[model samples]
Structure formats: structure tokens, C-alpha cells
Target: MKNLLSLLTIAFLSTGVFAQTTWKADKAHSQVSFGITHMTISEVEGLFNEFDATIEASEEDFSDAKYTVEIEVPSIDTGVEMRDNHLRNADFFDAEKYPKMTFVSTSSEKVGEGKYKVTGDLTFHGVTRPVTLDVWHRGTVKDQKGNLISGFAISGEVKRSDFNLGPDFPEAVLSDKVVIDVDAEFKKA
Candidate 1:
């Protein structure tokens, strides 16, 4: 009976030591994109070609997730070289001054079934502001290679004027609100 108690104690202690879990971006299957209204009539879409994100926690309750994401500002692509170049200047994203836009989650709440309201501060163009993202946890699956993968659909909006990244004529030339979306997949790391 003493031996049995000793073995059980060891097993319990070992489980705690190995309980930490980390999720890393599966970049090839993840994407970050944004859209903004143009001329009060049309919309312009773009994407960041380079980004990295991660989810870390003791368990799979993403409401307790430690989330961080970084996006390369210069990687913004609108499928037009000239437009992309123009956006990288001081008048816009100013990739030279702020090479990356980042989001580090401060808190999360389970707002509904399979949905979470993630509140975080987004830093962009030398400015930082609080933003809330509506995140939907798609599901988790184990692949043929035995790697566990999880998916999330996230969307949020930021005011360009708040970050001093807007055109002078925000109402006439472009809208103040920019909508961001991410279809992200992460693998157990």
C-alpha cells in the first residue's frame, strides 16, 4: 500500500510538470487581411504577407489564452505595387518608423457558445489603442501526423484617424474605420 501511494504521487507530480501547452501559427494556412471604404462608395482590400502569432496556456480554455501577434507593416499588399508602396510612406502606415503592428491580448471573455470577446491593445503607426476582437473558435483536430491543430476566425475594426494613419479627407477620400480579419490556424508546439 505504501508503494502504491508513492507511485501515485510521482505520477500526479509529473503530470503537472508537463501540463503547459503552446500553440504556434501554421503560417501556410493562416491569413490576415483588411478592408476600408474608399470614396464613400467602394472598398479597398489588402493583406499583410508576413505575420506571426501564438497561443499559450495551461489548458485549452482559450478564454484564458495568452495571445500575441505581430504583423510586418511593409508586407501590406493590395495586389498593386504602386498602391502598396504608397501606403508604406509617412502619410500612411509609415513602415520605416513602425516596422510592425502588434496585438497582445489583455483579457478574454466567453461571450457565447464557441465565441470569445478578446480585448487587447493594438499598436500601430507609433500609436497604441485598445481594441476588441470577435473571435470564433472553429474546432481542434489531430492531423494524420498526430499534430493537434486549432482554428480561429477573428474580426475587428480600428479607426485609422485614432492612430494618425488616415488621409486628411477621411470622409471624402477614405473611411476612418478599417476592418481587419484573420483566418488563423495554429499547431500544438
Candidate 2:
């Protein structure tokens, strides 16, 4: 009887230990981009070439998942070399002062199939604010190399005013709204 009890205890302990899975971002197959109004009529898009993310979740649905992502500020690219350099200086992102920006999930809710409303604190320009991202799980599959892969598409918006970037730029030229989009893939680790 004691041996049976010991077996049961070990089973439960191992179940808890193995329930959580970790996924590492596949940066080569992922992208993070942003868009904002350039002249109130045209949109200017930018991409961050370097970023990292990790996802941790229980074996069940990802309703309780935890997400963390960091983007290197110096990697900002807007397709124009001159403009990119100008934006990287202290007048804009001040990449030297704030080398990285990050987003960490505080809560997540599964609203529908493969969709989630994730609320998190976005820290940028040395400031932090709450943002809710619309996240969609693009499904999971196995690669030819026999590796598990998962994809996600995330979208959200933030007010530049909330992050100390609004007052620095003239409203007529650069709006206070910034849209973030991330289409990323992760490999099971």
C-alpha cells in the first residue's frame, strides 16, 4: 500500500513538472514591424531587425501563457539609410540611451479559436504602459527536419504621447499613433 502511495505521489509531481512547455523564437523566420502616419496622409513603415522572444505555457490551451519579447532599438530600419540614422539618435528613439524595448504579458484570455487577447506592459523609451495585443495562433506543424514549429501573428497600437515621443515631434508631421505588428515563429525547446 505504501509503495502504491509513493508511486502516485511521484506521478503527480512529474505531471506538474512536465506540464509547462517552452518555445524559443526563431528569429530568422520572424519579423517585427511598425507603422505610423508619415505626413498625415502617407504611412511610414519600419522594421526591427533584431529581437528575441520566449513563450511559456501549460500543456492545455494557451490561455495562461506567458510571453516576453525584447527588441533592439538600434536595429530600427525604415528603408532609408539617412532617415534611419536620424531616427536612431537622441532626437528620436535615442537608441544609445535606451538600447532595448520590451513587452511582457501580465494576463491572457482566449477569446476564440486560436485567438487571444493578451494584456501586457510595454516598456519603451524608458517608459512603460499597458497594451493589449490581438494575438492569433497560426497553428503548429512539424518541419522537414522533424522539429516542432508554431506561428503567431500579433497586432497592437500605442500612443506616442504615452511613451514620451509625442511632444518631441510636431503633430502635423508625425502623429501620436504607432501600430505594431509581429509575425513570428517559434520552435519547441
Candidate 3:
């Protein structure tokens, strides 16, 4: 019984030691931007300035990664303050009603050495949809603070009408498709 107890303690300690790797978003260094067609001739670009992500993976690979992302829709900037304000209103994001958007990963599949196909449920404007993001793992390294960091870039497109985005603009000027791009940096948590 003494030998068994000792072995169990050693196993528990080893598990804790091996679970040291963790990654968290460096919000100041991350960005989430989106673009969509405007009048079929110009593209309107906007970015959400406040967002964060959490990541946990083993040193061996990102296959075991778990990710959760949250974004503040009211913090969107389109370079034009007027347009940005309108976007935050009821016609678009309705920031007052749905102040935030989020994505929680459901599954991830490795398609290449540093590339993955991630499927998650994206909640926006009081609606949720299953979206797939093409994710590229840029790599991992140590930051100036001596913390481990991981970088990733993801891009995907979703239909605005599917989320009840607009009611005034004509289909010609406002395409249903919106392209989203994310450049995220994660640090050791």
C-alpha cells in the first residue's frame, strides 16, 4: 500500500509539471479586422480594437489547442467616425443590444504543418452561426518579458444578411458577404 501511494503521488506531480505550457492573448499586439463590398466598387474596412484570445497547447504541437475569443463590437473603427457610429447603431451591430461577439472553437483539424481548419460557433448581433476559419500558426517564441508567445492569423467570410445586419442599403451597394481577418498573439498565461 505504501509503494502504491508513492507511485500515485509521483504520477500526479508529473502530470502537473507537464501541463506548464499556456498561451494568452497580448491584446495590444492583436487585431481583428473586417471588410465588405460597398457599391461593388469600393471596400469598406473596419477593425475591432478590443479583443482577446486564450490558448492552451502542448510543446509538441498545436493539435491539442483550446481557444476562446471575445470581441467588443462597439470598439470598431472604420477610419470614418461617422460610418463607425452608424455601424454600431441598430442597423448593423446594434452594440447596445449585443455589445460583444464571441467565438468558441468546437474542433480543429491540421491540414498542413502549420495550417489548420478550425470550426467554431460565431455569435454576432444576437445570432450564432457555424463558421470555419483558415488558421495559420506563425510559430512560437519568447517575448521581451521572457514569456512564451504564439502567433496565428485566421481569415473567414460570413454573410451579413444572415445576421440581420442591414435594412436600408441596396444589395448592389452592400454585399451580403463580409470578410473577417484576425492577427492574434498569445502569451503564456
Candidate 4:
């Protein structure tokens, strides 16, 4: 009986030591933005006003972190009402049919000091494709309220054609490549 109790105690302590920590994005401090070339002349920038992201990690350096993100398609804003509406129509996102874009990380590899290469499956416009994004772990700190917070700057590029986004549009009208940039802060939860 004493041996069984010892084993149980050891198992409980091991589980605690290996427990994963979860962090949720602090909405007010996070932004999901994208940029695309327009008319082969200038870049048009936009952002999704509503998004949720979470990270799970067991290491302090976040080398083993898993990330998941969901963005509302109808929340896209380009600072122009007409353009935003157009983007939501069938010519572009078709937000009525597909209202959300999501990404679930399959792997995260630490390549340098505070730098990571994250690969994931991204689902948008009713299509799922593999994508790799560069991440800069901007470190973590304790807030004034004693809450732990971490910051990340993530960037990636995706071909709109791959996701059937604006299928009829030519590269001349709008660049096929779109750049995604996210500046996010996560509070430990």
C-alpha cells in the first residue's frame, strides 16, 4: 500500500510539472491586418476587426507552443465603406457564405533567439491549405495587475488564388499575393 501511494504521488507531481499553459489574446492590444497590391500601382491595407487567438505551451520560451486563430470575415475594414462592402460580396470574400477564417498550427520550430517558424492549416473561403508563418516572440512580462502577458508579431503571405478568393480577378486588378501581419498580446489564462 505504501509503494502504491508513493507511485500515485509521483504521478501527480509529474503531471503538474508537465502541464501546458494557455494564453488568450488580449483583444484591445491585438490586431490582425493584411495588405495587398492594388492595380499594380499601390498597396491597399485592411484589417479584421474581430479575431480570437490562443496559444498553448509547456515551455517558458514557447518552443513547443501551439497556436489557433479565428477571424470573422465580415469584420474586414479598409477605412472605406464602399470598398469594405465590396470585399464582403461574392467578388471577394463572400462573407455571407463563409463567415470565418481559421488557422490551427501543426508545428512550431524555434529557429533563433525569440524567432519561430510555425506551420499550420489555414481555412478560408471554404478551403483549407497549409501555410507557414514567421513569428517573433516579443517576450513576456507581468502587467501592473500581476497578470502575465506575452507579445507576438506574426507575418505571412498567401496566394489568393489558392483559397479561391476573388477567383475572377486578375493579378493586374489585384495582386495575387496578400501579406498578413498580426501584432498580438496574450494574457496567460
Winning candidate number (lDDT): 4
C-alpha root-mean-square deviation, candidate 2: 2.0
Q: Write the per-residue lDDT of candidate 4 for residues 1-189, one digit (tens) a residue.
A: 999999999999888878899999999999999999999999999999999999999888999999999999999999999999999999999999999999999999999999999999999898999999999999999999999999999999999999999989899999999999999999999
Clashes of each: 0, 0, 0, 0
- Top candidate when judged by TM-score against the true structure: 4
Residues 1-189 of candidate 2: C-alpha lDDT, one tens digit per residue: 999999999999889966888999999999999999977899999999999999999844567789999999999999999989988887888899999999999999899998999999999888999999999998889999999898999999999888886466886899888999999999989
Q: What is the C-alpha lDDT of each candidate?
A: 0.91, 0.91, 0.87, 0.97
TM-score per model over all chains: 0.91, 0.92, 0.89, 0.94
For residues 1-189, write the lDDT of model 3, one tens digit per residue: 999999999999888766756688888888999999999989999899988788767644687676788999999999999999999999889999999999998888999998888889999899998999899999989877788788999999998887888867777989989999999888777
Instruction: Select the stronger candidate by TM-score from 1 and 2.
Output: 2
- The residue-by-residue lDDT of candidate 1 on 1-189, one tens digit each, is 999999999999888965778899999999999999999999999999999999987756576787899999999999999999989998798899899999999988899977999999999998999999999989899989999999999999988988999566556898999999999999999
Order by TM-score, highest first:
4, 2, 1, 3
Stretches of candidate 2 off by over 4 Å are 2-18
Q: Give candidate 3 misplaced runs (Cα > 4 Å).
A: 1-21
lDDT of 2 at 41: 93
